[model samples]
Target: MPHSIPLIRAAAITPIRRWVEERGEDVGPFLARADLSWVPADDPALPVPLRSVVRLLVEISRAAGPDTPHRIVNGRGGFEIGLIGRAAFRGPTVRDGFARIARMMPAHCTHEIFTVALSGDGLHIRDGWAYDLGDDEALYLVQQYVASLIDMICSVAHPEAPRAERVEMVPHPEAGLNHLRPWLGDRLQPAPLRALDFLVGSDVAAQRFPKGAQERAREANGETGRRIASGASLADQVSALVAVMLPRTTPHLDRVAAAAGISGRTLRRALRQNGTSFSDVVERTRAQIAVDRVRNDTDVSLGSIAADLGYANQATLSRAVRRWTGQTPRSLRSGLKSRIEPGKPVSETRLSK
Candidate 1:
């Protein structure tokens, strides 16, 4: 069987609790419902189920009303930047910090993937889901996440640093614009994708953190990363590696083992210890990448997706889709397309089984 996706660190919810209470709303019941037991001050590092975090946000929004999402997210700024934030702040330069955060996001929040890329005149930071947040909640969640990122960037950035030139999101109603204005200002614009652009100067990117702060932060982050990796079984690591490799080439045990810095025999021994095989990891990785691409990228055709996954043809992909999802490739594609329609409920799009 494929390994279960990792849970998100509890620190992700710290800001929510803080903002909710600041609004004078009782958060105890909701936290209990979400099964969260600690506050931001507690500095809890325990991982919580991603569904529970989503549920907590949904429940908080319901209780606090529709504007709560914007209010809470904006009010807290980047106070709840989580583990990724901590590690990033410890880096020597702003660019280095942002890069580190992007790399560490997968270990912290496996439900979404983030990328920082350089555009012609500026840097474009894009975010896409590894799992669906559904349509009803997607906008608010996306806003909250993107806003938090903007806040983090602004906090450490020099006064002369690159300003956020543009902020884009899936089209949303005009009502929420008020809450976003303080952070995003006039830069907010509607786009087909979710991304933020920063016009950073070389000096800004090179600005160093305070003396010894970067080193201490890096050490702490390294320890945290190690702990996170140490918790995963060897099979889980191989599966993650295979997932990343599938888009570029067919992942083999030897390559995977080399990537893991182990001999093939040792890799086999590790997997056997974990009660799995190399082939099992490959299938699970392919199955995961297939579903993710299908659900997230509507413009990409089935044949193209199959080719990316190293499938000989779309027919093989269709068969594999049927086996994995109990639905044909066309049907799966249709469901994904339908979910992307504006105002449609997104409860049906599930990545975790």
Candidate 2:
């Protein structure tokens, strides 16, 4: 399953910059490394973007903690940086530090971080870091970070797990260069996307978290998420839920519940416990998603966009847009677009005929 798509991808990158500053490093080292073979940020040959891959490596490194090497790339536009750091270790039974990386990862990375959650009792992680790194040093740093995260996850796992979960490097044909079967008896997959997969027992995970910690974990770094959502404001809960499921038509409560694995009643109860109602949720989400999407994606045509949002006609869509966001569709588009393109009228609809 796709692990929290937005969080994983949205990690804060400041730590990477801080890490780089500490090392007195330059992008040159990555270019000089002989062992590193990288595809460019613009490489069309691969399915994933180099910058994104680099971004993941950096998040894992920072989450691993301090005193580790770091690497970064400066693409002309929208490029990313990387860093490597030490892993956190706690508890004797959880001997593998790598497993802890997997466990704690949700706390450190963003919602959009590249992650493929394997379904199993225990997790085995393999990893890959992408770069247009023309140098071996940068690539090596990426490799070490990947290896360290795997090590962290494995160390935290229960000593004897019944089944294993395979995680491999995204860029590898058979996981990563460390393809050899481990003597330690890990069940590793030599597949690309599984490189970061870990062998973790869900039962153990249940026991590891503190009371209410998982929910807290979910809220961590999630600045946009609501705190205790239900009764406070139906509009707010609906807004938050829609934010979580935008661009995908119909933010059905049941679907949200399924994504969260909670029953509709229970989900409603939790929302109520916090402060809101289900009807409020539906309205808030629909309104917010509509406004956000219309303002955010310029490429989508107005009519198609309206239809995707379940509006019967452009006029109804326009009215609803006005209700949610005190502005007409044209005004909304222009205002939002102006932030990205300076001086150009932000809204596409020219007000004067």
Candidate 3:
């Protein structure tokens, strides 16, 4: 019999698998229970029933505590490493990015529809699901989707990242409230799940990407536009230096600036001209290096890999790997290909110190 339930892309739940493994538990039992054991680890775009995925998340949450959903979606990379994020970041502004994501999201998951609106000088985002999965499953799914959406918006905005002034979420237990308070803070209010909502300021949301088109053209013409007549692109140069320095010490802005024979302020200005911040470059460098090492070097211990990548320990690197690839290091080393891609230079160049 053909089932009528909506389907979510299998890629959407890889993070859940990584989380289960990170806790030192086997994923076979969980996948077996969800009837998802047949889903190939290598195939990301395969479809699985949305109800099954939500139930799997709810099951994990029950086993791991309410924080599982938050941890899965609230990580640094969020959805930007995925397909929708690549298309969205290529947009002209933060608000445009949201629109692109809203339009393209259905191709990734059918259960939810994303809507973006302008309310005077602010932006309102709403996530409306096609069908209810009941309270427990709905709560976890809402957290996973909504948090990823907010993080995607903020990441595209970069340094001028807009703050979510008000957010309304489905009612939760007090323990769940505590887990969420750190991220949503005082802006959170209990509301029905008709639609999950968030509001962000217009100025940052409307900040134009002055260099987006030019940079994209340049990258297409050359190999990532690594060079110019005078020297390498400052951002590329800084990334190279950071990658080299990761194993030795923290690539602090001041230290990296000195290595590049420029003052910290001057280096910051150069990177800003290239449409990135010091922290952003460092983050990209770390993600690229981490993915390369994990995918290519199966014999390397994760602890060693973490130390080489400047992470404090294996567990920290594991979380970062999960965020970047939606899979754990072991999973990646064992043959799961990373689905992350580097986003375009979409951040607006800011002059303010």
- State candidate 1's TM-score: 0.54
Off by over 4 Å in 1: 1-6, 35-43, 62-80, 159-162, 172-179, 194-206, 210-223, 226-353
For model 1, how does the per-residue alpha-carbon lDDT over 271-326 read when each residue is reduced to its tens digit?
A: 87777677766776677778777766779998999898877788887777776776
Give TM-scores for every candidate, taking all chains together and pairing residue i with residue i. 0.54, 0.34, 0.54
**Alpha-carbon deviation at 35 in model 1, angstroms:** 4.4
Candidate 1 weakest lDDT stretch, 10 residues: 344-353
Residue pairs clashing, model 1:
none
- For all candidates in order, the CA lDDT equals 0.60, 0.40, 0.63
Kindly report which residue pairs in candidate 3 clash with one another: none
- Go through the candidates in order and give the clash count of each: 0, 61, 0
Model 3 lDDT tens row, 1-353: 11123555666677777767777899888776665665666555554556657767777777777666767655444332244544455666767767776876776665577788997877788877766656744564565456655755465455433367777766554454556677667877765655778776777677654465324522332112111111246676566656645654566776566544357888788778778888877887788888889888778888899887767788887887788788988788888878777744322112122
Q: In angstroms, how far off is 63's CA in candidate 3?
A: 1.9
Q: What is the C-alpha RMSD of each candidate to the true structure, in Å?
A: 18.7, 16.8, 21.7
